[model samples]
Target: MAMPVSDPGRTRVVVTGLGAVSPLGPDLVSTWEAVQSTRPCVEPIPEAWEAFWKPKSRFWAPLPKEWIQCPLLAPLEPKQLDPVSILALESARQACSGGAPAGRGGVFVGTGSGGGASRFENHLNHLFPQKEFLPGRRGGRFNPFCIAMGMPNSPAAMISIKLSIEGPCRTFSSSCASGTVAIGQAAQAIRSGEVEWAVAGGAEYLVDPDGTQFHGFDVASTLTRIPTREECNRPFDAGRSGFLFAAGGAAMLRLESERSARERGAAILATLDGVAENCDAYSPMAPAPTGERIQQCALEALADAGLLATDVDCINAHGTGTEANDRIEAAMLERVFGRGPKVTTTKALTGHLIGAGGALEAVFCVQGLLDQIVPGMPNLVDPIADLDFVLRTQASEHRNVLKLSFGFGGHNVALVFTKAGTP
Candidate 1:
């Protein structure tokens, strides 16, 4: 039977919990503190990295080797925790710390290049000239687990199984915009009363040798010869080059407004006032230079929140450190904020998390609302536009914020998160 439609006045959505497994840190607190300090997380690829790629890029940010030691992850074998799975599990575990409500709750996660490393490595092992291919080799049928682990939807499936969640489960993959779109879709579901709670976020692990070769061949990664990871990505700087590659995950709990959260006594992190998504349909790999769709998406989100451009206090920019993205994003902000509000790009610190960028940026925006502070952009010495780019230090106060993310295939998403009880 079809479910009943939600009464427009009946349900409201708000953020009740948050989590992250990022280059900056494993959890929200640690990640936020590291971001505030502008600590660079990028590093030289490990020795094993060569097995994955040739003519390699300069730097990438891989999770610390110690993350597998966390008590929450003790259930799984160390080899089982591939980068994508590790990020998904860690972020979901943190987000659901308070426990999702007893009834149906949804799970949505986005990922780009899901588990490509594991699949590629397994393939090469069998295909090499010296190696023999056999049906029963090692774990029979080449271990169906590889496809299961590498599947983009595996993260959401794993999260649902781990948490025993009995409601909707979905995995969205729209190139780089996958994560943000997941959150937006989850919010819509809750607001429309499809579910009581939703776990939403994105994860990625694309720094592997196979992953790098694919991305570098596509000419999407920064090719700088810089020795240090810190100098690899320079978003919005006049001397900006391109985005540094990185891997990470972020997730958040969305509940039906303050009333439901307070009724269940869940901690209210922030309010997700509005969200909007748009597609340019112009190009699959690049955004339109005029940024018309991006501007439209932002305006729609602000309108959904019942606010004007001047009402937003800060912006989490989708600054990918690429020339086309930064310039187009700057134009969009100028069109919407009339010079743009206080803006910062966490990508400067975390690098681009691809499908995970949107959800992580959403978490950052929520943090800006809850902590009343805005994190700064790193390596942005010269301004690219007339906008106020938060730099060097974090902002002292932020009440309302807009988080924007644009991805390949011209996917644009904007989310407006307001302080609790804001009019």
Candidate 2:
């Protein structure tokens, strides 16, 4: 299977549509509005926290139940829809509605801890003291579809099926970097002439009590038991503790170019100039603290776009609020830009959406270009180092934005986006 490469000058990737299902909102417009306002989407645990690992952290960004209603799951009863399926469908539908091209469209979605909550819930039910010992009870096979929907690739498959995307369909699960990797792959496919259009994004829905317990046990999350959402996530701030857990989905459509989208009368959202992905191979959970690989990723992406660091006016950082991540990312940007660009972390507003974070933040980058505004870090009261973090107020002047994402498995991805009219 050889991939056909187009003339280097023949193909150009562009963003024609965008979609999102986040704690901030269910769709792109709403989410962008929420981001501009610096709203805090984190909240206290919906149910009894005691049931989930002694309530080390009482807050998280959980999506609403109604936010998942989508056309993809119309065949299934509402109660039967898994959270992951709901997220994927919602994101896909929104993207499709926004002008995904007809015949040649494809799908690629990223996910982490797919359907973990459903599996945990089923296991707990089977373990009940008075449970009947049915034939499948021990193995907990009551819902056969559970496993089908729980697989990491389920989101991509479901989106493909729902959208009737008969072309390439795939899923990436590189921890938090999954979304950006998925989008980067989609863009590469288009550039290689493999597909004309693609629905690319990521989803996450692991907010169940037992699922929270597992995360607590992992000790990777920031256990800040703040009573209010405003204080939960503080990216690039000295007071920042760790990454806040969040759940949601995000999607975008990668088209061949504006000419192709215009031929179909599709609404052009933004220009996807270039994307680059690399791995540090340094550590499984931690990034190469020197930030060399990620810096290279940024440099590579800028070169792909034929642009310079000075040309980038803003950057959507992978600021996870974790000490190591924020510091490393800050230093990397400083080294690359000499002085860091106007930087912000949406994770402070939406918490960290794990695999979905990068895709969702990429959407924010597009919005920044389109709306001429860059979101601010919501609660970063105390500054860290000498970086210029847009805090509490959105920036109104941004032409080119760089979106960066790093994952636990040493994955790093950078996307460069220019304004619609930019050369």
lDDT of 1 by residue, 1-423 (tens): 122232346456778878887878777788888887877688776655454346446576766565543345555543564568767767888887865564468988887767766676656554653444433223223433666766777778777877777789999887778888889888888877787788898877765434544356335544434455666678887777677667555555454555568788887778887788999989977789888899888888887776788878888889988878899898778767855478888888887888888788888888777877777777788878889888864656767788888888888888888887664
- Highest TM-score: which candidate? 2
Q: What is the C-alpha lDDT of each candidate?
A: 0.74, 0.76
Q: Which pairs clash (backbone N, Cα, C closer than 3 Å) in model 1?
A: 52-209
- Which stretches in model 2 have alpha-carbon errors above 4 Å? 1-10, 75-80, 98-100, 125-141, 221-229
- 14-89 in candidate 2: lDDT tens per residue? 7877788888887777887888888778766655545435555667777755686776565654455467767877
State how far residue 175 of model 2 sits from its true place (Å).
0.6
Candidate 2 similarity to native, TM-score: 0.90
Say which candidate scores most in lDDT. 2
